[model samples]
Target chain A: MSAAELHNNEMIHGYLNDLRRYLSRLAPHETQEVIREIESHLFDVLDQQAANGQAADVAEILRGFGDARQLAALYVAHIEEGAPPPRGFRAIQSVKKSVTASLYFAMAVFGFSMAFGLLFIAGAKFLLPESVGVWSTPHGDSIVVGFVSVPPMATPEVMGWWIVPVATLLAVGVAWLTRKVLLVLKQHM
Target chain B: MNSTEALMEKWEVQLRKGTLELAILAALQQRTLYGLELLKLLQSLPSTTITEGTLYPLLDRLKRDELVDAQWVQEGETRPRKYYQLTPLGNKKLTDLTRLWRQSVSDIEWLLANPGPQPLPNTGV
Candidate 1:
């Protein structure tokens, strides 16, 4: 019989969740995936040992891996130096920070864009129908173009694409600046 | 154990501490074992014990670095266990570290064996 048969699936689920949460400080982006890999490696080894009739304690097994402080310190040193992440993990932390900033910026831009879109739609509906057709000062032709009943202010073309990229870049800059400020202030803290 | 040995256990972690990573890696080079098994093996050596929180993280770092490879296997009808083993790189690192450590020990021993502290006291009134 294997470990799955001995314990409920929920136990493993909970255990894996706990492991991910515990490792979050170090590998926030790939925490769960990293934990799963480690967990799989551990279970395989433990199972073999158990096959030899040796009793095992999961927590102790986990603990024997060694001190996280020293390990985290090494990673943090790389981060501060702006060096690549250690061998297995990539140094995508700065990327994540940039993306997170961009997301927030996008949300802000989205709210303003939506307001602009709505105002354009409403302005088109209200102002276009108030007059039969917009008359140009130089032409004698008042070319009847609208049904007046439907409003002719064709919605102002939304420049969502422009907003998205601009917002994202602005957000990334802000996030980068914020991180620098925090790092500078850490000594005082 | 002698009286000095007993005293050393309490205060010696500070003294023999810089090479702990070397110590742990050397221990792991012996076999592929899970966290607890590694801990037990390290402890079973007679005079040392390492905390669990500290050990596991270091192991994860090692695994992440590809210095070690780990796998999970079902132990019983109940739960799976994780085990670690040295990669070729890890073995090489262990071997190099061992030689360096041995050299340092010899160098330090040689230094300690030959020491002269004869300085005349300066008296200025």
Candidate 2:
């Protein structure tokens, strides 16, 4: 064979190899069938050119097939469309989507409510300083937080004016964390 | 390309895409042709010209849809070629599409023949 023919064969094989790689999603036999058909078509075109006394132009022929990846994509697209999803596959996908959506809402509710409660406590501390205080029982067996009808007897209040800043900071941190988490969940949804 | 040329090209692409299946079905009417022959036949026509990338995939789809049947035919000493022919369903589709195509052409022709400043006939309004 001539050097030009050898080079043409190499180029044809190279293009077919790339096409085969891109068609991996197809079944093995189907991939082979696609490859075989294309190879046959290529050779037929070359034979026609030879019969017409024209040189084999592998590049021009490959151009008609366009990019290997794009051609494979077209074949894959139709196969996917032809085969409907398995029974209940769509149901599972929807369930997963809803689960993410519900998780997002649940996280939003839990986080925002916690932040709101903290901010409320901070506000209440200023309005009813005497009613709301954190106290340790006499034996330190238990600690009590939030409003009380009357201040605990003989137990000193902790976080005396600093509770406002502490509660506000905690609220801000929880709110920020909630926002970030919701953003992540939203993407999945 | 100039904007006008670009717009014309886009319109042509849309027109080609819309009619491609009909064209393929019509081409295969009472005829069995392999990929290369079919591609050559289509490229010979002005509007039905398409690439190997487009033709093979579309043929695959037509086969899958039962609109066409393909078989690998091997002649003496030559490579096997997958030849395609219209199935009954494909022929039915071609007939239906031909009717619609004729209807569309006549409608456009009527509109062209009847210019503005004259009310279209057969309109109750």
TM-score for each prediction? 0.43, 0.66
TM-score, candidate number 1: 0.43
Over B4-107, each residue of candidate 2 has an lDDT whose tens digit, in order, gives 99999999999999999999999999999999989999999999999998999899889878999999999999889999999999999999999999999999
For model 1, what is the alpha-carbon lDDT of residue A151? 35
Relative to the unseen true structure, what is the C-alpha lDDT of residue B108 in candidate 1, on a scale of 0 to 100? 95
lDDT of 2 by residue, A59-127 (tens): 999999999999999888954666854343467689899989889999999999999998988899989
* Model 1 lDDT tens row, B1-125: 99899898757776445666677788877687877677777667654466554566567667766789877766667456677889998888889989998999898996677565743234221
What does DockQ give for each predicted structure? 0.26, 0.57
TM-score of chain A of each: 0.31, 0.53
DockQ of model 1, rounded to 2 decimals = 0.26
Docking class of 2: medium
